[model samples]
Target: MILRTEIATILKAPPIGETVTVMGWVRAWRGNRFMVLNDGSSAETLQVVVDGEQFDEETIRGIGFHAAVSVTGELVESQGAGQAVEVIAKELTILGKTDLSTYPLQPKRQTMEFLRENGQFRMRTNTFSSVFRLRHAVAFAINKYFNDRGFYYLHTPIITGNDAEGAGEMFRVTTFEPDSAPRDEAGAVDYGQDFFGKGTHLTVSGQLQAEIGALALGKVYTFGPTFRAENSNTSRHLAEFWMIEPEIAFADIDNDMDLAEDFCKYLITYCLENYLSDLEYLDARIVEAEKNLPKDKRRPMGLLEMLRFVVEDDFARITYTEAIDLIMRSKPYKKGRFEFPVSWGVDLQAEHERWLVEKHFKKPVIVRDYPKDIKAFYMRLNDDDKTVAAMDVLFPYIGEVIGGSQREEREDVLRQRMQEMGVHEEELAWYLQLRTFGGAPHAGFGLGFERMVQFITGMGNIRDVIPFPRAPRLADF
Candidate 1:
C-alpha cells in the first residue's frame, strides 16, 4: 500500500528517520544518484538520493528528466547546499519514463516563444510554474477581498444582447450557418429566427447586468470570462479574458476611486503575505532575463520592489484635463518622442498613460472626469456638460488595470446620452426601466484579471499569465 506524501508537505516539515512514499515527476537526475522530484504542490522540489547499487539497472536507467516514479525513502538531512533535507531511497518504481531525445523541453533555458508553443509541458518549467501559481493566488485573493467586504458574487450571462462598452467588437453567438441563414423581406439576415430570437454575443463587459444586482443587493461583483472580437494583436489585448467588476449602490465617483485603491492594495498585499516564495522566484527570473538589455530599456525597479511600492504608496489622483496638461509638458512630448498625439478630448494611449505613471507621478495614478464624447453612455454627465464622471486606475508597467465610473442614474440623462451615442433605446428597455423604477446613485469599475496577474508575476506578455491563451491566430491547449 502506497500512501504518498506530497513533496511540498514533506519539504515544509521534514519527518527525519521516517520511511515514506513520494510520487512525482523527476525534475532533474544529477549524476544518476540525486533525483529531484516535484508534484505541482509547490514551486520547491525535493531531492531523492538514489544509490545506483540499491536499484536495479533498469530502474536507475528510467530515472531521467520529467520521468514519473514512486520512491519509498528515509528522510534525512541533506549533505548538499541548496535544500535542508534529502531522501534516501529504499525502494523505487518507474511509473512513466521520458525519452529526452524526443522531448520538446530541454534541461537548459528555453525561450518563452518556444515554451508557449509547447504549453502542454510549459507549466513543468520553473518560470511558468511560478507564473501560474501566482495567477491562482491573485484569483483567490480577488474573491477573498470581495467576499470579506460584503460584496455578492454575481454570475452574469456570457451571451448577452447589450453592448455595454458600445465598442461593437464582440464575438457573435449563433447556430445558423453563415452562407444559409434566414433572410427578411429587405434581403438582410433575419436574426429573429435565430436560437435566442435575436442577435447576441459573448459579453464584452458584465457591468450592466451587475448593476441590476447592485441596485437590489447593495454591493455586487461579477468575476467571469468575457470576449472581444477585435483584431488587435498586441500584448495587452486578448480575444477571451476575465474581468472583475464591482458595482455599489449610493456611491459616487470619489467613493468608487477609494474602493478601487483599497481593493487593489488588498489583493497585492494578500499575495505578498502568502505567496512570497513564488514571487521571489519570479522576481529572480525577471532579473536574469533583463541582464542582456541596455540600461535604458530595462525595468526601473525589480518585480517585488514594484509590487511593494504599489501597495505601500498612495496612488496619485488627478482629472483627465490635468493628466493631458502634464503629458503635453513632458520631455518626451516636447522632444517629439511620443507616438500618439495628446489632447483634451482624445482618449489616452498607452504611451501617454505610461509617461503619467512612470515619469510624472512615479506611482500608480487614478485619472478621473474624462470627456463625455470619448466615454460610454452609462457614465454620469458632469456638471460642466463636457466631461463625464469616469475614472481609470493606471499602474507602473500596465497602463490601465481598472476602469470604472459613476453610472447615469437619471432616466432622461441616460436617454439623451444613448440617443446622442446612437444606442438603440428599444433594446435596453429593461436597463432603462431599472432607472425609471428604483435605481439609485451607483458606481463601479472593472479590473482585467490577466493584466493584474501579469503585473504581479512580471510576465512580459499577457498571454503568458493565462493558462490557455486565446488571441489572434493563436489558440492552443
Candidate 2:
C-alpha cells in the first residue's frame, strides 16, 4: 500500500511516477466534476479528480468541507507551484464528516475575531492550520536550541504558597466551598483549613523555584504554564500563558541579555529555515490574508543577523530616570501623540513601551535600573538605593518581549526588601535560604510564549496564535 505522503514532499518531487494515497478533508468542491481536498499536511490542496463510474453516488455526494477522507490515485506532474501534483483518485474512503448544516467554517475568509469564537474547528481552516504547525515547530525549536546548548530542562511546581514574581496576580485554586467551609473565629473563609493546611494559589511565575535548580546545576530552563489573575483583556494579555524562563547562575544582567537575544534569534532562524513551508503559509494566507507582500516584509531575516542585531545592534540603554526625562521633554499639551501619559518614577505601560521601542529607538531597546518601588523585591538594589537592577527588553511590534533583572544576592538586602514589601516570610524560607548558602549573582528572564509567536508570525493578537486561550469571557472550546 502507498502510504500517504505530505503534499509539500510530493510537490518538491516533480515527476510523480507511482500511485499515492492522501488523507485529509474536502476543502472545496466545484460543480460535480472537480474538488480540492486539504490533507492537513500542507497549505497546498490535492486535486481530487473523482469519477462517477468507479465511485458510488453516495461516496461522491457524501463529502463536505472538513470531512476526513482517504484518497488513492495516480500522481501526475502539474504545471503550477501549489497545484504542482495532481492526484487522480481511483478509490476514495470517507473517514469522518462535520455536519455542514451547523459547521460555521465555509470555503471563505474568516476574521480573527470570528475564528476565536469557533476555535475547535478553526484548526481545519487554512490560516490556523498553518499557524498551528508553525507554532508547534517554533516550540520544538525552542526546546532544541536550549537542549543543544547543554541546558537542563526543569519542571517547577504549579501550586505554590509563595508568589514568585510578586505581581499579586495569582489565581487561588482552593477546595474551600463558600457554602459549607470551615471558618475561623473571625468568620472569614478559613484558608488554613484548606488543602495542604494552607492557602495555595497557582504560580504566577516559575522563575524563583527554577532559580534553585539553576543554582545547583549551573544552568536550567523551564517551559510551563503560568497563571495570572490580572483581569486584563488586551491584544497581548492571557490569563494562562506559557513562559519560557532560563535562569543562569553566576550570570549578570548583561550575560542574561546575551542569552535572551541568542535564544530569540535561534527561534526565529529555526522557523525560517526548517519551518519555511509552514511559515510561508502563515505569511501568505493568514496575516496578509493571501495578499501580495512587499519585499522587506516578505520573509523574516536570517537568524545570526537577528541575534547579532539584538545584542550588537544599536541598543539604547536608558535608565528609568532618563526614560522619564525623555517623556517629560515631549509634548506638554500634545495632540495625536504619546498615547499614554508618562511621568518620572511611574511604571511604564504598553503604549509607552511601544513608543520607546517602536518609535523612539526603532530597534530592540533595553531599559534598566527601574525604581525599587516599581520593581520586584528580588531585584538587586543599586548603590543609588532608589533604582533596582531590573530591565525590560522592548521590541518594535511586541512590547516587553523579555523581562529580567540581576537578583538580590545579599541576604540582608533581600530580607529588608521582603520586609518592606510585607511578603509572607514564613512561606519563603526555602527561597531565602538560597541567598544564605552560596547564591551567586544570578539572573533570568521570562519570555512570553505568545509574545514570541507574535514576533515570529506577525500575528497581532495573543488569542490568534494559541490553540485554546483562557481569557476572561472566552474558552467555550
Candidate 3:
C-alpha cells in the first residue's frame, strides 16, 4: 500500500529513500522528467521526477498542466538546485486532465483583474492561495480567541423581519413574483400576502440578535454572513460579507474598546506566528507590486513589519471630536489635501481615517464618541447630548476595521432616538423589550471579515481576499 502524503508535508522534511504517493494537480511539467505538483495543501509545491527509462513517453506527455495525478515514488535527494528533495516516480497514474487551450490559469504571472474574472480557479495561483490560507488562519484565530475568553458563539438568523442597521439598504426576501405581486388598494406591493406574512430581508448586521445572547449568557459573539444591497463599486464595500460582532452585557464603551483592541491584536499576532511563510510570500508580492509606485505613495512597511507593528504597539485612543480637531489643525486639512473637508460633526471619510491611522497616528487608532447624528440610533447617548459612545477601530491600510458602540440601554432614550430616526418601533418591539426589563449597560462592535483579510494579505481590492466575492455586477464564482 502506498502511503499518501500531502505535498506540503513532504516538502517540509523529505524522507530520503522512503516510498510515498503524492496526489495533486500538476503545476508545471518541464522536459520529460520534472513536474511540480500542488495539492492545495500549502503555498509550496513538491517536485516529482519521472525516470524516462521506466515511464513511457506517451504517459509522460499525458501529464498536462493542472491535471490531477498520483505519483508513487522514492523520495531522494534532489540532483537539481532549489528544492532539497525530489520524488523519483516509479508509477504514474493520471487522475484527470485539463485542456490547456481553455484553461484561464497559466504557468506565467497573471494580472489581478484577470484572476478576479476567473475567481473560480484563482485559488490555484500562488498569490491567491497565500491570501486564502492567511484568511483561514485569521478566522481560526478569531474563533480560538473568543472561545478561550469564555464567550458563547451565537448563530444569528440570516433572514430577518427588521433591518439591523436601520439603513434600509437590505435585500428583500420574498417568494412573490415582483412583476405580478399582490397589490393593495393603495397600488403598493402587499407584503402581507407574502410567504412570511410580513416584509423580511437579508440581515445587514447580527449585533441586535447577539445582544440578546449577551444579556442572557453574559458574553457572546456572532461570526456569520451579512448582506447589504448598496450599489457601491468601491474597493471597500461588498454586497455580501462576513461580520465578527461581539456583544457583552454590563460593559460600557470603554470596555468595548478594550475588547476590540485585544481582539485585533490577537488576530494579528496569531497570523504572524502561524502563517509566517504565507505572509512572507504575500509580503514579497506586495513589495514587487508596489515597486513602480511613487516613493511617497509606497507602503512604508512590508506585510510582516505592518503585522508586528500592530501586534507590539499600543493603539492610539482618541475621541472623535479630538480627531476632528487634530485634522482641522493638521497640514493635510490646511493644504486642502483632504477630498472631503474636515469639520466637527461631519462623518470621517476614508481619507480622513487614513490620515489618522496611516499618517497622523502611524498606528492602529480607536476613535470614540462620534456625533450622535452621524451614528446609529442604538448607540448610547453621551452626557454632551450631541455625541454617542461610538468607537471605530482603524488600521494602517484599512480605515475602519471595527465599528461599534455602547447600546442605548435606557428605554426612553432608545424610543426617542428610534422615533427621530423614523424606525418603526412596532417592528422592533422585541428589541425594545430588552431595554425595558432588567437591562444592564451593554456594548458591542462589528468587524468586517474581508477587510481584515485584505489588510493582512496586503491585497488592494476587497474582492481579492474573499473566496467568492459578491459585489456590484459581479457575483460569478
Among residues 3 or more apart in sequence or in different chains, the pairs in candidate 1 whose N, CA or C atoms overlap within 3 Å are none
TM per model?
0.98, 0.89, 0.96
Query: Which residue pairs come into collision in candidate 3?
Result: none
Error of 3 at 186 (Å): 1.1
Which regions in candidate 3 have their CA more than 4 angstroms from the true location? Answer: 1-3, 30-32
Residue 314 accuracy (lDDT) in model 3: 92
CA lDDT of each candidate?
Answer: 0.92, 0.79, 0.90
TM-score of 1: 0.98
Cα lDDT tens digits, model 1, 343-391, are: 8899999778888888888889999999999999999999999999999
Tell me the tens digit of each residue's lDDT in model 3 across 1-477: 746899878877777899999898888877768999988888787889888888888888877778889989899998898688988888899999887788778878899889888878888878888898999999999999999999999999999997878788999999998699999999999999999999899999889899899989999999999999999999888999999999999999999999999999999888888778888889999898889999878886888888887888899999998999999999979998878987888999878888898788888899999999999999999999999999999887678889999999999999999999999999889999998888989999999999999989889899898988898898885
Q: Where does the lowest 10-residue lDDT sum fall in candidate 3?
A: 2-11
**RMSD to truth, every model:** 1.3, 3.8, 1.7
Stretches of candidate 2 off by over 4 Å are 30-32, 52-58, 79-82, 285-316, 328-336
Rank by lDDT (best first): 1, 3, 2
- Model 2, 327: alpha-carbon shift in Å? 4.0
Highest-lDDT candidate: 1
